[model samples]
Target: MASHNGVNRLFGGTGGVVDGHVHLWDTAAMRISWFRDDLGLPPRVGPGDLARAVATSPVPVRAAVAVQAADTEGESRWLLRQSAAHVPLPGPVVLQYDARPTEPDAWAGMAQAVIDDGATAPGVAGVRLAVPGGAADLSDVAGLDALCEGLAATGRVLETLVRPEQLAAVAALAARHPTLDVVVCHLGLGTGEPDASWRDALAAVAARRRAHAKLSGLFTTSRDDAGRVAAAARAAVDLLGPERLLFGSDWPMSARVAPYAEIVGRTAAALPPLDDGAAAAVWSGTAERLYGAATRTSPAPRG
Candidate 1:
C-alpha cells in the first residue's frame, strides 16, 4: 500500500478488505530458508512492514490472517506474539508446521501438542499443511483425522496448500469431519492440469458445507494473464459461489507478478455476475466467518 499510483482507483475507496492469506517472514527470527536474498525481498517482513505495505491501498485492510512462512512452531509462536502486540488490528494466524511422511508419529505428536497449546492462544485461528513445491498426498499423513477433529473442536480452521489433483482428498477429509472448516489455498495452484479435473475437484470440495476456497495467488499462478485469471475466477465463482470464496493478496510474493491493487482489481473484474451482498462475502465476510468473526471488524464498505 506504499502509494501505488492506481491503487485508489482500483479499490475505489472501499474499506473492510479482509485479506484471507498473508505471509510474514524473517531469516533471523524464523527459518525462511526458502526465501533468497537474490529474490529482492527484504531480510525480514514483520507486522510493521505489513502495515506499511497495505497503508496506501485503496481499501482499508481491516484485518488479515497471517500465514506461517516456515514449517515450525517457532514461526507459529512468533506470529501469535506479533498478533497480540502489532499496531494494526492484528488478526488470527494460520500456522505452518512440518508433518513429514517419514515421521508420522513424531509429526502427529508435535501437531497435537501445538493444537493443545493453540486452545489458549487467542490468535490461533487455523493451521496450514503445505506440501512444498509438489502436489500434496494426504493419504500417508499421520493422525490427519484426529488433527482435523481437534481443530474443529477448538473452532479452528484447517488450511490446505494442495494442487488440484489433491482436492479429492480434501473433499474426502471434509466428508469425514463434517464439522471441521477446511479452506483450500491458492486457488488450487496446479500447473498443466486438465480443466475437467480442476473443475470437478473444486465442485467436489464445494459440495461440502464447511469447505471453502481462497481467491488468492491467481496472479502468480496465472502469470498475470488477464484472460486466464478471469477465466479461473469465473470458474471458481461459478462452482463455489461467492459465499464460499475469500479474497487474498499473496503480498510480497505476488509483487513479482503484479501490484497488490492489480491482483485485487483483476480478481474483482473476473468474477461472474454477483450482487452487492455476494461481493461483500467474497471480499471479507467469508474470511471473517472462516478465521473468526471476533477478530475482524464487519463494517460494510461503501460502493
Candidate 2:
C-alpha cells in the first residue's frame, strides 16, 4: 500500500479506497431494462462520470470494480472494452451471462464457456447474478453448481445480489463450494433495523471463511436515514469483521438519493471506528484479495 502525498496508489491503497461495487451504463448503447428515465440517472454514465463523482471524496477511490448492469454477453464485452479504455478508473469489470440452463450437461457447457471467455478477457474479474428469492429459490437455481465449480477453478469470484433472507442460502452455497470466493452485495440489502433474522443470516455468511459482504446500497433501503445506514454498517463489522468486508458506492443508481461524494461521506461516517489496518481492509484490502490481480497490468486495448 504505497502512498503519494498521503493518498495511497491504486490497487494497494491502505489509506485510499477501493469501491468494490460501481455500475456504468449507457442506455442508448446498452439495453438496461431498469435504467428508466424516471429513475433519475443520466442516460449515459461512464468512467469519467464516476471519476468526477469521487474526485472530491475525503479518501480518494484509487480503484473500482464495475459490476454488470445488464444481463447480456454484449454488455460484458462492452464493459471489458470500457475498462480497457478507461485505464484504471474501474480496475476490473464483473460479467453477467445466462446461467439458467436446466440440464446438467447444458449447465456444464455454459459454465465452461464463461471460464473460456474470461481467460481471454483480462479486464474481467468475476460474475454477478441476481438471486431474487430465498434459500429454497437458490436450491432451485439451474446450473448454479456448475457455475460455482468453474469460478472456483479459475479463481474468479461469484458475487450475488441477494435479499436478507437469501443471505443464509448464500452462506450455504459458499460452504458447499469452499474454494469459491463469494461476495454478498449491499449487506444482504437489509435496512431499517438490524433485526435478529438479518443478523443471523449475516452471521451465517460470516461463518464461511471465503465469503464477504459489501457495505453499499444503504441509501437505497435506508433512504435518508443516515442512522439506519450507520447501524447496518456497524452490524456488518460486528458480524463479519473488517477483513471480510468491502466498500462499494452502488453509484449512478445511488445518485437517485444523493451525489456520489455525499453518499461516500455518509457511508464513511457510518462505518464503525477502526484502527488503520482494519479500516484499510474494509476500504480496499479485502476487495483486492477477492478480485485478485485483474488490474495488475493494463488490459490489451480492443479495436
Best lDDT among the predictions, by candidate number: 2
Tens digits of per-residue lDDT for model 1 on 1-303?
A: 223434333343445688898888878887775788788777787888778777755667888888877777776677777877874445777876455445444332334445445343556777787863554557666557766765676677888888887888899999999998889897775323337778888888989988888888776445446667667777788878888989888776776776666666666666665666787788888998888753322221111
Clashing pairs in 2: none
Candidate 2 structure quality by residue, lDDT tens digits, 15-132: 5788999999887787986667776678888889889988966667788999988776666667777887886687787776455454444332322343345454466677776766
Clashes of 2: 0
User: Whose TM-score is greatest here?
Assistant: 2
Q: Evaluate residue 194 in candidate 1 and report its C-alpha lDDT on the 0 to 100 scale.
A: 31
Q: Report residue 240 deviation for candidate 2 (angstroms).
A: 0.9
lDDT of 1: 0.71
Residue 193 lDDT, candidate 1, scale 0-100: 34
TM-score of each: 0.84, 0.86
Measured over all alpha carbons after superposition, the RMSD of each candidate to the real structure, in angstroms, is 6.6, 5.4
lDDT of 2 at 108: 26
